[model samples]
Target chain A: MSRVRICRVGESQFAAALLPREAAMPEGLSTRSGRRDAARFAVYRNNVGVGLTRALERRYPVTLRLVGEDFFRAMAREYVALAPPTSPVMLAYGSQFPEFVENFPPAAGIAYLADVARLEDAMASAFHAADEACLAMDALMAIPPDQLGDVRLTAHPAARLVSSPHPVGTIYARHGQDAVSPVTHWCAETVLVTRPHIRCEMQVLPVEEAGFAAALFSDEALGPAAEQAASRGGFDFGRALLRLVSAGAFSAAVNSAEKEARHA
Target chain B: MSIAFSKRGPRLGFFEVHAENYMGEGGLPHHQLRSIAERYPLSLHGVGLSIGGEGDLDRDHLKRLRRLVERYRPASFSEHLAWSTHESAFFNDLLPLPYTPETLERVARHVAEAQDILGVRMLLENPSTYLVFEESTIDEIDFLAAVSNRTGCGLLLDVNNVVVSSINHRLDPFAYVDRFPLDKVGEIHLAGYDEVTDEAGERLLIDAHASEILPDVFDLYRHTLRRFGPLPTLIEWDNDVPEFPLLFAEAERVTAALQEAWRLQPEAAARRSAA
Candidate 1:
């Protein structure tokens, strides 16, 4: 057979056998003694299973802590079997895992597990996101007070906002602890993850500012975003904008007038 | 790794990192690598290219690798002889392939294409396999030699893989080293392996880089150095990674062996320098 046909035939069987736990020994493989040793083939299977599971474990430490090691490993094995990585870059391998956890039956009882997974995924993404200079506080202050509302801000390349109906920020913050304090107040939370500098910083946005922050992230001009945020009472637009700017959320600020002039 | 290389750890010859891990556009990985690149030579080792896959290479992946090379301009680039992806699913492990003429041609084409796209001569490392293929018509050394000759690529003679594969196949490690095209070797890798038993109760070695380099592997490494002269060697301890001090100690052992090899084979050193 041609090499393509040979590899197609052999690798198809080999790939088929790797993911499934009870797959029979792939054909045409042998030990030095010419026997089709299941144990020998099992090594490859174990490498694939263990290697991928470890990758997930590295990415989702909080999830592992929540479920404990054994449970997490079993769950990760299922995730690996179902959604094997489609890309070679492992940094983005388990992007679909949070959704998978949401639909997983065993983890259904933990209502906040999926959200926590989402939070962790967002943190990983923010950590790996492209680096860019954040808009300096002085730069924001340099805008004339009259035209401040016309300024549009761009979200930093490394900024990620994850809003969840559960207090995922508290749960995520308790990572690496042996014993986590009970979260007495079950409430909605929004986490803004950003690699402002070398360290990845996660801050839980207050409920009132979540809408304003989301609007800004979606590239809304400050005037309109704050107006919509103001309709909902207690949304301090000044405080929220200052907080996000200090946290290095936005990268650049462009006035709507200047933007229009450039377009013209 | 950046911490070890940068902070109070022992200074070594060079540092290697998996290319896939740094595929991100920009982040701590790039930051750390840039700092390390400024201080020492960098070896960009890839584990995800699947150069030995039956299918055509992933162009997007090749593009990403090219971008990394252009950004870093690493001293050397190497990948395993095993395949890691099939169809679109990446297994993340270096899976074995049968050595056949047809496979040889496909691998050569892929290597050439990679070299053409990467704009650099690459090194192909030998794999430690647990199973053999019934369709394998060419010996492993000859297969690597042919690929090197066809593509003008260098070989990364991993001594740990030599011991693991030789013992797994019940072949002689010394003989395998003798057969290898030493002139084409640009770098060397020494890692530890885990031992297990096969179905027939025979010993099987898995190339698990979780522990210290074994005495047997070290012996094979010294033998290789004696034959091929001292080359740039890396101590790969990915899993159960110890403190920087311990990993550096492993490097120290390699250094000692390398010095001994240099002392023993002055003529080999001269030949290498002349070449």
Candidate 2:
């Protein structure tokens, strides 16, 4: 009979995810007692899984509402096992959840579930992103043209521009007592999330404008981004600019009045 | 922070809120907590201080904690006796520290420095731990008493934790109640625990705070009531929080018990006089 013990705190923390030392022990009284420890361990494991799932539910109430609570908890449990909290800091957790749902086997049946989660994760990221003031329309008009390319445009840290294959905009707009937005047509919609105030607001963007904003946010020059939008055929640059400004994405627009300083 | 819109201005209840979740802004959670802060006194209950570590307390965690206190102006502040970080690893659970002279000095200095910087007194809550380290020299109650005496800080007697720790270590919990330095006890915590069997075939309860208070714990709490009298007690049901009304009901139970204890005080004095 091999004597065994689960490593103590200094030896190995049960809270940590390491293989238990009791693996080699013979099954009997020790096993029964192990079951007891295992029962205690189950409480902790359940709390971590449920806590993270609830955090996800809070992030994507619309998604949870869409699937219903029973279905949502079941799916969330799967998502949590795959991606348990990597950081003690929860705001830093669940960045991959949107992507996780996209590839989850169970989520395949509900094609729109992943996109809804993506929208929710994007909103969570936007809310916790570094704080910066949005550039007023006047701030942009104040910029000179020469510095436009040289002055790299900086987007709000909280701003997230998402292009989805689902009509998340309409779904999200219908949010009420129901945890999920009403399922609607699967239009390839583009949405922009911005924190103009403490509350998060999402707006559906026209394809033409989304292209320009996405490119610019990725540090692409305006000329290329505009050219990319132009290549999209029937992309209206003038209307896109008006929409971008109206959405309050810009922090401060500086022109290359200096002709070379990159605006960050 | 939203001021209460009620004609009565605001309720005078005091409370504590966890600090880590609200460290960053632009979220609705922070906005709601700030609104609550507007109407009531708040305490920044810290989880990451790791004051009892062998190494110096994590400077970054302390600085972040400081920033939160500066912003919120909480009426009180507190942290646990156990450490959360060790050997550069940050364990989310409050792991126990060996009750020894070395740990006592480290934790005492940490508390005094925290008070000096925050310019306010802080309370230390004792931990409910499972395994006892062979490295310790002192008992938990005495270590806490020493820390309070050395640092001039107060104690946050978690009665449920005292009972849990006593059971795990095979000690009489009332002995803990009798030995505890009553003068330094500033506040109290009453919460639930889940019981499991140990390898010795004895029952071991974990402080999970999900279930209702066990009768044995309430009995021990009665001892605490006799020893410490009424302090601002909080019924924390972080896990499986039934509803707002349920939590209020639990608090009412503890408050009613405390009031009953006070109610008997004059009768006890009369009995002593007649004797």
Q: Indicate which candidate wins on lDDT.
A: 1
> What level of docking quality does candidate 2 show?
incorrect
Candidate 2 chain A, poorest ten consecutive residues by summed lDDT: A24-33
lDDT of 1 by residue, A30-84 (tens): 8766677989889989999999999899899999999999989999999999999
Interface RMSD computed for candidate 1 is what? 2.4
Work out the TM-score per prediction.
0.96, 0.74
Task: Pull out the clashing pairs in model 2.
Answer: A65-A179, A65-A180, A147-A255, A147-A256, A152-A263, A256-A259
- Per-residue lDDT of candidate 2, residues A160-253 (tens digit): 8888788877677776444544455658888998888677788988766777888878867656677788988778865786677667676766
Candidate 1 accuracy as lDDT: 0.91
lDDT of 2 by residue, B144-232 (tens): 98989998899998888988888876788889888888778777888899887765667777887886777888888877877666567
Candidate 1 segments whose C-alpha is farther than 4 A from its true place: A1-9, A261-264, B1-9
Q: Residue-wise lDDT of candidate 1 within B124-203, one digit each (tens)?
A: 99999998997798999999999999999999998899999999999999999998997999999999999999878988
Instruction: List TM-score (chain A only) for every prediction.
Output: 0.93, 0.77
